[model samples]
Target: MIRKIRQYIEAQNLCLPETKIIVGLSGGADSVVLLYALQRLGYSCVAAHCDFHLRGEESFRDEQSACTFAASLQIPFLKTDFDTLGAAHQRAISIEMAARDLRYEWFEHIRQEQQADVIAVAHHRDDSIETMLLNLIRGTGIKGLGGIKPKNGRIIRPLLGVSKQEIMHFAQENALPFVTDSSNLQEDFTRNKIRLSLIPLLQSINPSIEESLVQTMAYLNEAGKIYDRHIQEAIPAVFDEESGRIHIPLLKTFPSPESILFELLKNYGFESERIGDIAHAIDSQSGKEFYSEHYRLVKDRDAFLLSVRTINHEPTTYLLSPTTREIQQPLKLRMRLEEITSDFQIKKENAVAYLDADILQFPFIVRKWKQGDKFVPFGMTHFKKLSDYFNDHKFSKPEKEDAWLLCSGNGDILWVIGHRTDNRYRITERTRRVCCLMMECG
Candidate 1:
């Protein structure tokens, strides 16, 4: 088993000979065997254990066994306790999921603190088979059917090529100290039910079901690589990263457009069903919008705009004095007082504003545009409603909401920052000094 583990590690290029590893030692049969095998294979190892405190004394017993085993091997040990049930309740997740999340999260923390090359967990062939079945039952995609990977970022599974039966046999042969969590016998959790009931039922029909599933997962893993490569090549054709827009027409040109969109939008929090719905309605759902937890997707006439959901907090008014050279809260702007010269040329860019300094009052007010707001646009004689200006310029809802205004102390609109400047404050021949404000784009 140790030789198999060494072969798997080398084949996967998991780590170097001198690579320091943080082993997730639960003192279970699988993890105990993993720690012993990795040590025997000549890798530097440190044992880290988590006491989730869900199984009461069983949790403490596991921790004690882990600490004792690490000590017997003269390996450094680290342990932490968690309120697993409380965490599950707080997160609104199952206890099994909460425990897994907390365990891996703490394992990464230990790895970073110890400066370990990788964090090793004892996920053997049986565990991968179980994971594949679980994901299939939960409606997973192609990636889920591939089962657990040998390496995931800094986390490595050295026992992925080893079987549970092999691990037990090796532990018994080596006289290893390990503890069994009695909870495994309970059919309470979904994973426990799968292991205890579903797998056994399958094995009863086909004696080599595990081997067949493992082989199927191996084939799926290779196929997933090809699928991912096609996805990588197709992404740039449909999605524009700069504008965060997925062009509907371009997306429709691809085969299996819904599946393509699913892969594209999944990272942005869009679910498979929602992505499929969007894809089906892409042509007819103009002006419709969909929202995920942290992102918003708007279907325009030609494309889908993906943007982060921002909080609609009350607009803050920042007062800028003459001495205030710059203000960064609402947006970044560099302010400078410049004297008009004979050869001075005004920049025609919309991002810059050249205001008559003497006409403007001190302590300028910077605030977002509000209802009934009007401004005399540059070179215009009459005041125009901000709404009319926005309509004429074809501003989107987000653009209008994000618009900022620069007002004089007496509340006279001077400039619509980054859009237009009031004609009343425009630089002219009579203007001796000018207030130059330039919006800095990130």
Candidate 2:
């Protein structure tokens, strides 16, 4: 089993000779075997354990066993305790998800601090097969079907070629002592239910179910590689990093736009279920928008704009006093109070707004656009609803959400700030004091 693991590591190019590795030691049979194997293979190894505090005393026992095992081998042991339930509540996520996030984040930190070449986890063929099954049950694309990878970035899974039976046999042969989590016997979690009930039923149907699933995942991984190649080639034509947008024309050049879009956006927190809706909107309308946890996608005319959602805990409305020269919150703007002269010229740019200071009130309000908001657009005689103005300008939902309005003290719109200005406050030849507002985005 050790020879097979060594050959697999060499073939996959997972780790270089004499590389420093950090092993995720959970005190389980698989992880204990992994730590022992890496040490025997002549690599500088450290055992890192995470006690999620989910199983009460069992969790602490696991940590203790892991530390003892590392000490027996004279390897450094790193451990951390987490308030798993508290983290789940704070993140508004499931306990399993919170634990997984905490585990990986801490592992990465340990790897960096120790200057380890790669962080190795004890995930075998059974775990990969289970992952593929879970993704399939949830309705996944090619990427999800590809299952677990042997090496992903700085994380390497050297035990992927071995089965659970092989790992158990090797552990017993080597007289490796390990602790088992009591939670594994419980059927509360989805993974536990699948492992305890679903996998046994499947094995009853076909004795070689795990092997078959592994083979299928191998084929799917190859197909995913091809899919990734096409996406990389298509990205140059479709995505523009300078403008931070995706061109719709180039996206249509692909035969499977829906699949291509799923592959492109899956990493950006977009779920597989939302990709079809996004693909449909790509051809249906130009103002449709979709949102994920960290990013937003807007379908603009002939393009899709991607932007990070800003979280502002500060007050949304900012005040500009009569003597104020600039305001920076929400957006950057330079305010200049000057007397309009015969040589004074109105700037043609929309970002620069010149208003009549005498007609406006003090403490100008800078806030986001609201529903039913209306303003007399510059050069227009009648009032226009801000919604209608947004529609006329073909603003997407995300654009409308991001739009800020500069208004007078009496709640009258003065400028749309980077788009249009109100006619009520526009500078005229009869005006004496001019309030020049210039927006600086770059």
Candidate 3:
């Protein structure tokens, strides 16, 4: 078992020899075998365990067993408890997902604190097979068929090359003490159902089904390498990083455009179904928008415009007193009171707005533009609707949404900031003082 794991680690370049490793020990057979094997191979190992507090006393029992096992080996042990159910309710996620997230997050924290080279988890071959089957049941792409990888960033699974049966046999042969969580015996979770029932039913049909599935996953992993390379090479043809746009015509020219789109967008939190809808919008009308949790993708006339969603929870309104010099949030701006002198020439730059200091009041308001907003152009005598002004300027939807309005305390628009200043607030010949507002460049 040690030799198999060491070879897998070397092949995957997971870590260096004698480097400190943070091992996730759940007191289960798989994790116990992994910790024992890693210690036997002469690597510096620190045992880390997470008590999710889900299974009543069983949870504490598992933690105690893990702590004792690490003590028996004279290894350092670290443990943390989590309110798994509370976190799930708070995060609006499943209990299993909440526990998984909490466990990995705390493990990474411990790894960095201990200065470990990498984090090792015992996800054996059977776990990867279960993951693949789960992804298939949920409807997945080609990448999902490749199963769990041996290494992902700082997380490494050294036991992925060994099966669950091999781990159990090795644990028994070495007389290693481990505790079993009763949750595993109950078919309450989808994964447990798969292991306890579905796989057995398939095994009854074909006794060697697990081996065949593992072989199939091996083939898929190899094919996935080529597929990934193709995707990376083809991305340059359709995506423009500088403008954050994907050329629709070029995208449609590719075969299986939906698959390409899905691969490109999956990391942006977009699901497969939404990605399929986006692909279908290629021939549809422009001005359509799709939203993920943190990203917004707009179907423009010629391309897809992708941008981050403006955080709604952040303050949209900001106040600036006469003595204020600058503000960083709700957009950056530098403000100062300037005097009108003989040689003082008003700056004509669009980004610099010069307001009459004598006419202006303290505590100016800066906020996002809204519908039915009206402002007078610097040269025009009449008020113009902001929507019309946007249309005349050919402002895109994103640009209009991002526009900010600087106003007086009386709720009158002072400047359509960074674009045009209201005529009512412009400095005139009688103005003894001036307020210069400059929008800082990013």
What stretches of model 3 exceed 4 Å from their correct place? 71-76, 89-92, 112-115, 233-244, 253-256, 311-348, 353-389, 404-417, 420-438
The TM-scores, one per candidate, come to: 0.80, 0.81, 0.78
Task: Tell me, by TM-score, which candidate is best.
Answer: 2
Best by lDDT: 3
TM-score of 2: 0.81
In the range 173-209, model 1's lDDT, one tens digit per residue, is: 9899999989888898788899999999999999999
User: Which RMSD does model 1 reach against the true structure?
Assistant: 4.0
Model 3: which residue pairs collide?
A: none
lDDT of 3 by residue, 102-180 (tens): 9999999999999998999999999988988999998898889888998998999999999999999999999999998
- Model 2 residue 40 distance off true place after TM-score fit, in angstroms: 2.6
- Model 1: what TM-score? 0.80
Overall lDDT per candidate, in order of appearance: 0.89, 0.89, 0.90
Question: Each candidate's root-mean-square deviation in Å?
Answer: 4.0, 3.8, 4.5
Model 1 misplaced regions, further than 4 Å? 16-20, 42-44, 67-78, 83-98, 105-116, 169-177, 204-207, 236-243, 314-328, 332-344, 354-367, 370-394, 406-414, 422-437
